[model samples]
Structure formats: structure tokens, C-alpha cells
Target: MVKGKIAIRRITSPKSRQVTFFKRRTGLLKKAKELSILCDAEIGVIIFSCTGKLYEYASTSINSVIERYNKTKRDNQQHHVTAAEIQFLKKETESTMQQLRCLQKYNRQLMGEELSKLSFEDLKNLENVLEMGLKNVRSRKDQTFMEEMRELKRKADDVEQENVELRKKLRVLSQDHREIKGEFAAETSSSKEMSKSSDQAMPDKDDIPERIHLQLSLQPKAPSLDAHETEIK
Candidate 1:
């Protein structure tokens, strides 16, 4: 009897699923090995079980096969560029170069260079453009100069105000210093006067005999002998 082909579906039984997985994994690896040996070609197979187990077979080193595959993919991509695409790229390049040249020429003209090829009308238009640009530049320059001047003036005013405040502070300090000096001088003078009075009121003990001698010397002397005789006559 001819058996019917089994339908492809998920196996619900755990035991049957595990047994099927083991058998398929072993068969797949065996087929890969046989194919590699018979064909003498590189082969690689990777499988993952429902339990997240990894199984792989490689006739050559896996790394070498992956590198060769990536290199071939890159080569195929490079070879896939058509003539139309090349032509389109060339056109784009030429357009970009042409625009660059035009910009360079325009810059030279603006700089008053390469004017020999310009017509009279073109030169007139260029002259107008240059004049307008110069006028704008001068106007901006004047505006910037005025702004800077205003800023500088403001700064100078601030500095002047600061100087005024500082001068006021200095003046106040000077006045305070003068007042302190005057008070100190007055105190010093008072101290000196008090000291002098104390000295006069309380004379030194050693100076008492000298003061007494001075007073005796200053007293009126007794009349001389001649003066006394004249008085008697």
C-alpha cells in the first residue's frame, strides 16, 4: 500500500516533538556532511531547537564562508550598476562642476576681475550691483560705528559716575580724617595744658631748695655803706 504524505503542522505531543527534533537535527547534519563530501563544495547549516539549543555544520570554517558570502554580495552590488545609471551619475557630476564654474566666474566678476569678456551693458549692471553692495556695506559700517560709539559713551558715563561717587566717598573720608585729627590735636593740647598745670602745682622736691634760693637772690639787697652814710648826713 502506498502511504499518504504527512501534512506539515506543529506536533502537539511533547515527547513526539522532542523525538522528531532529534531525528531531524541528526538527519539535516548528516545530509549537509554528505553533500559537502560528494560535491566537494563548501556547505553550512544552522539550526535552533524549540529549547533554544544551537546546532550548526560547516564543511569549511564558518567564518571563511561568511566572509566569502559578504564579499560576493558586495561584488554583485558593484556589478549591478547599469550604463544608464553611470550616465546619470556623470550628468550629475557635470552639472555640479558647471555650477561650480559659474559661481567662480561670478565671484571673479564681483571682485572686478575678468572684465575683458563682459559687454558694456553687463559691465553697467555689475557696476550698479557693486555700488549697491558698497552702499549697504558703508551703511552697516556706519550703524556699527554708531552703536560702538554709543556703547563706549555709556561706559564712559558709567565710569564718570563711578568716579563722582568715589570722589564723594574720598571727600567724606577726608573730612572724617580732618575731624579726627582736630579732635586728636585738641585732646593733645588739653593734655599738655593739664600736664603743665600739674607740674606747676606739684613742683619737684629736689627743685624746692633751688626755687627758694632763686627767690632769695631776687630780694632787695641791704643798702650799701656809702648810701647809708649819705642818708645819715
Candidate 2:
């Protein structure tokens, strides 16, 4: 006759539970050994009776099997951690990429390259922002321009002062030059007049001798005695 299937539930009686645990423990250890031999696998089994008796089996040393199991569990946990970190990085990268795309779109909109989606209110706000930015830029530019103009004016004033000083120096030099030239002319004229006076005061060689001869010839000739008696008769 065929037997009915066992329900496999916990036995109510302590004695029956203990018996079932022993039988199952033995069968489990035997199956583990057989499986290891058949599949060339490392296998381990462990059980505890209701009375707290320990039972165990291993294809290799129990300590070695336990160590291998612990090592494998640790490797699996490390792998899971690594995979989770990779997934998180991928998610962060995707989020960053999305933010980058948003920024690019916003930049294009700000540059007026993508205006189709902007509402009237948005356009008004953008216009106001642009106008404000323009005003600020113009204000800065004007301030810089004024500063440059002031600098240029200061430099021009400095140059003008230098020119005035140079003119004064030139005027003084010119006056000095004029005074030197006048002194030289006066000296030259005085030397020429002295030369003329010296030439006039010296007597000529022909004048002195001719004057002596003229004086001698002009003396009255003594009258002859015969001419005088003829005149008287």
C-alpha cells in the first residue's frame, strides 16, 4: 500500500521532536557527503538537537569550510557595496548632466537664442534685467571715462606748467644773448673810433717837409741897390 505524505510540521511531543531532529541531521550529513563526492564540491552541514547537542559535517576540515564560507560572504558583501557605489555615481552623473543641460538652456534663453518658450511676463523681466545691466555697464563706463578725462586734464596741466617754465628759461636766455651781443658791438665801435683818432693825430711825411720849404721861399727877397737908384732917378 502507498503511504501518505508527511505534513513536515513541527512535532508536538518533545521526544518525537528530538527523534526527528536526529534522523534529519543524519540524513542531511549523509546527503551533504554524497553531494560533495558526486559533484566534486565542498559541502558542510550543521544541526542542533532540541536538547542542545551539536552536530556538524564538512567535505574538508570544518574550520577550513567555515573560513571559506566567511570569505565568500565578505567578498559578496564587498561586491554589493561596490555595485551600489557605482549605481550611485551613475545616478549622480545623470543628475549633473541634467543640471548642465538646464544651465545650457537657461544660458541660451538669457542670450535671446531660445525665446519661443518665454512668456510675455518672462520677456518683460528679461528686458528689465537687460536694461538694468546695461545701465550698470554704462555707469561704470562713464565713471572710467571721467576718470581718464581727469587724468588727461591733469597731465595737460602738468605739460602746460612745463611749457611755461621752458618759456621763462628761453626768455631769460634770449635776454642774456642780446646783452652779450650789445656789449660786443659797443666794444667793436669803441675800438674802431680809437683807431681812427690815432690815424688822424699822426702827421704825414709830405706835410712837414713841404711846410718848411714853403716858409723859406715866402721870405721877402732883399731888394737890389741898382734897381732902387734907377727908380729914384
The best candidate by lDDT is 1
Write one digit per residue (lDDT tens) for candidate 2, span 1-233.
99999898878988888787778777888899999999999987877766777888989888899999999999988777676889999999999999999999977877888888889998899889889989999999999999999999999999999999999999999999999999999999999999999989998777999999999999999999999999999
For candidate 2, the 10 contiguous residues with the lowest summed lDDT are 44-53
TM-score of 2: 0.46
TM-score for candidate 1, residues paired by index? 0.57
After TM-score superposition, the amount by which residue 44's alpha carbon in candidate 1 deviates from its true location, in angstroms, is: 3.5
Worst 10 residues of 1 by lDDT: 60-69
Candidate 2 yields a Cα-based lDDT of 0.91
As a whole number from 0 to 100, the lDDT of residue 221 in candidate 2 is 98
What's the lDDT for all of these models? 0.94, 0.91
| Superposed model 1: Cα runs more than 4 Å off | 1-31, 35-43, 46-93, 202-233
